[model samples]
Target: MMRLERGSSRLYAMMLILAVVVLLADQLTKFWAVSTLSDSERIAVIPPLIHFRLLYNAGAAFSIGAGATWVFALAAAAAVIGILYTARRLASTGWALVLGVLLGGAVSHLGDRLFREPGFARGHVVDFIDYGPFVGNVADIALTCGCAAMLLLSLRGVPLAKTPEEETA
Candidate 1:
């Protein structure tokens, strides 16, 4: 059984806050895109590199499995569950933030899958940030950054938590 440290509550609260902030930002940006942009419109914010182009993605990243809406939904659900489990074990603020961002991103995309175009579970995710040949949303950015943070932490050998033996080492 894993026992949480005395300071874990504060970290957990921070994580929850981070998750909510990411969710709100993602939803707000997507809502704006959906309400303001036409399906065929592309607004360039940075020439040759970035643009705000509304895209309805029914698949996972990069448009792979383009028509597999249910598959993507399931994957997002699994990611949320995994994040929840990992969040409880997180011993550092960095891990908490990363998990929160990841969870928020998953939830944001899942919300679109349940409530956006088409119908529940078959709805498409609204993507607007277009850079190069790839189009993504705020949620995708959060997830990507969170994954990178996790990778960096792992490479630095940041102690997630000490094992029982290691605690005594």
Candidate 2:
């Protein structure tokens, strides 16, 4: 039991490290994109398949909101809070890792919205990396993968919530 506890501790540390690395990489890549690409301009890395297309998204994934920057910012904040709360409750290493990734990605994009273009929380998220029709960023990829991981875990019967009765039982 002691050994298992140690192992779990190590796993948690590893997950935290992975999250930090993801956040750093995402931020760095975004900085590069902002510095290199002009707004709304695309530089093709591979014609029609992959390109570094600079875009400002004032909405959720795929620019869903289109112009409601404040709403998106609020939503991102709520997501970050929810993820952090979930992370605190996570016992499984896999869940921790997934939450970490999701949190990191959220933080990265949220940072951009708070500090980048258009001013304060009214700012837009900078997105690049156009693969054919879809354009996203490193943070977006992390969020997607994290969400997928959580979904997979849920599908595989990994319990996400533990009630008081279950804990006592």
- lDDT for model 1 comes to 0.85
| TM-score of every candidate relative to the true structure | 0.90, 0.83
Q: What digit string (tens of lDDT, one per residue) describes model 1 on residues 34-86? A: 99999999898989899999999988888888788988888889988877766
**Candidate 2 stretches greater than 4 Å from native:** 1-15, 161-169
The total of clashing pairs for model 1 equals 0
How many clashes in each candidate? 0, 0
User: What lDDT does each candidate get?
Assistant: 0.85, 0.77
- lDDT, candidate 2, equals 0.77
Off by over 4 Å in 1: 1-5, 161-169
lDDT of 2 at 61: 74
